[model samples]
Target: MLQQETALQKLWSWLFENKVMLLFLLICVGGVAVSGNSASFVIENVAIRFGRNAFTVMSLLIPVLAGLGLNFSIVIGAVAAQMGLFFAVDWGFNGVMGMLIAFLIATPLAMLFGFGVGRLFNKMKGSEMIAGLILGYFADGLYQLFFLYILGGVLPVKTESLIIPGGIGIKNTIDLTGNMKYALDEVKLVDIVLIFFIIIAVISVFRIIIKLKNKEQSPLKDLIILLLAAAVYALTYVPAVESMLMTSKLSLLNVFLIIAVVGIAYAIWKIISNKLNPDPKFKAIRYITIIVAIVLLYALTYIPELEKILMNSKVSALPLALIAGLSLFNAAFLSTRIGQNMRTVGQSRVIANASGINVDRVRVLAMIISTVLASWGQLIYLQNLGTFATYGAHLQVGQFAIAALLIGGASVSKATNKQAITGVILFHTLFIVAPEAGKVLFNNAMLGEYFRVFVSYGVIALALAMHAWQRKKKPSLELPA
Candidate 1:
């Protein structure tokens, strides 16, 4: 009884520490369950949303590192991206070249905006969040003025349809028919899958080779697992699975067999290698996980209604590649002296200053980097969307992106790429499923929209309150700036 109680206490403590993640998890599960949507449907949209919003959410990290809270001025970066994109469209530049040009144009603009925001944040140190938020609105007004009145008149826009009828301002809605649509989504699905499988097989083989050098695993068992995985993949050449996947159905059995067989093979190898504990509870839990996973495949696959909703669950290679690049950049950035200085300022400006670091410059650089990333992110997003609302596209970017970050368990003072990616998945899961769930329950999709809106603001509010409460409790440990 005492042991059980101790275990429960540990669980509760972990939940408390990760409450944001836990709450989002619950919301996602509830949304999925109530919506009665197919897993593929939810996953497809979530993956796309991850690509759309992950970079922007990540952009908030540097500003957070500098203790600037959520950089609501990231919208300024979006504004910059839009201006670049506007010109690219006007210049009749299409495909990849247009996107690259947009990025080049947005770079200087984002840096300028970011530098200004950072300087202002330094002046309003303790209230950086509010200042950033207010600055976003102020910047929006300028963006509107530029787009609505200055584009054709001041800036030479040659494209006729891009500008309004009176030839003064750009159009409210820009059709990206010939310009940079799907700029990051041009992928051949089967080729991508082959590449993925090749990478996985190579990694697995390398791991096995290393283990063999150490005499850790049964080579026979590892070989059997490899053969089994290869056989399952060979089924893809059968034309049945290919046709099925090409049509995009929720074939749970197909997915489960591929996963379960691989999992079983690995598990058996582990046991044979003496790597896994053969205890009763451990064995029972492991078998149950396998069983439940396979059972779910059959159950979900048999449901006819679910089949109707399963959409094309294909992954875009470019977005995944870009995400990997950004993650690597973050890791590399954090290993540098500038990164250490950024961290020091985030901890306490006084400490950073005492250590002979230029705190102000570090903060400005952080913001500048964030803004540049955000600008690129917006470009990626617009290309994916294919068309965009010229006047209102970037309006709520900072709010939703920050909300997603906070939902992933980030705070005002600290964040990570892990948190950003996780938050994008969970928040977008809710974003995708909640409306369908709401329509099923209340017959009103608007209710779900309102709920999502409230959630965005509510999360920001909750995070701020928590930050304040922590500050008040640790008054002695107050960050000196």
Candidate 2:
């Protein structure tokens, strides 16, 4: 009976912890059903939306880690990206070169904007979130002033297409169709793979050097993992495998099979590693759960309708790689000294300061990093979108990204890479299906649009409220006399 009670408690805890994710998952499933959209259509739309928005959403993570809550000031970073794009277009830079130049221009400008925002946040401290929101509005005004009064009026631009009739202000919309459309997305898959290999090799060499310098044991495990991964990648070179992969769209079942194979391999590795060095903390239940999930996913691929949807979805290779890279970076950053400082500062400024860490500096660094990332994310979004909305493109960036993060069960004090990725998928899935669902149920597509917008704002508000309530309920530390 005691054991049963403990098991029940554990189940309850898991449910409570994952309540938001589970709810969103259910809503997405229900929305898809009600919308009556074909699975293929939804899958295709979600794949495109994910490529466009994932990076911007992930950009919010660092500020949250530093206890700055949602960085609404990411709009400022978006502005910097637009400015770079403007220059890139005005100079007649096109294709991949244009995108690269825009990135180069955006980076320093974003850094500058991020630095200023960081300083302001340090002063605002407890109210950094609100301060950032207001700063975005404030920055927008300056942004308009520069583009309207200064860009063409004070500083002439060569591009007539970008200038208004009176030539005083820049146009409200800039077409990137010829200049930078599909710049990143059109990158050859082979180039991306080659770059990935080079990056891995570089990192491996660096790690070996560090190990040697420290007189530590050789990183045999790391080398083994790298070799194993390379071996798997090499299988793609087989004529049959290569021909299949070269197709415009891959079968959904194949994708699931690939993932299942990787998961099974990892699970086997864990079992062997556990045998060699037993860990009390290791739980076989996790592997069991993962295997179950893989099985379910694989089973879904066997369903005809689901299979069609999966096969029909075409993902952009470079953008997907970038998203994965950013996720990996988030995980890697958290293990670094600076990331630890951000975490420490986030937990309690008083404690962080007391521990001789410069809390203000850490917070500033976090904002700077977040802002710079937001700039790059905006670049990715615009390049994929193939058009630049000079004035309106960035307006909803912060709100939507923050909402997505919050919807994924992230709070003001805590978030993770997994939560951010999951939130993007769920939030965007709802975004894609909600309007159709609304139209189906209520005969009004607008209603669905309103509902999704409401969900975006509502989720953020709910997270904030929950955060405040939790703080109030938390017990304060009391020193004994």
Worst 10 residues of 1 by lDDT: 245-254
**Highest TM-score among the candidates is held by which one?**
2
lDDT by residue for model 1 over 338-373, one digit each (tens)?
988888899999998999999889988999999999
Per-residue lDDT tens digits of candidate 2, residues 79-173? 99999989999999998899999999999999999998999888987998889999999999999999999998889899887898988899888
Model 1 scores a TM of 0.73
In angstroms, the error of model 2 at 90 is 1.8
Against the true structure, candidate 2 reaches a TM-score of 0.88
Give per-residue lDDT, candidate 1, residue 54. Answer: 83
Task: Give the best candidate by lDDT.
Answer: 2
Total clashing pairs in model 2: 0
Candidate 2 achieves a global lDDT of: 0.83
lDDT of each: 0.79, 0.83
Model 2: how far residue 9 lies from native, Å: 2.0
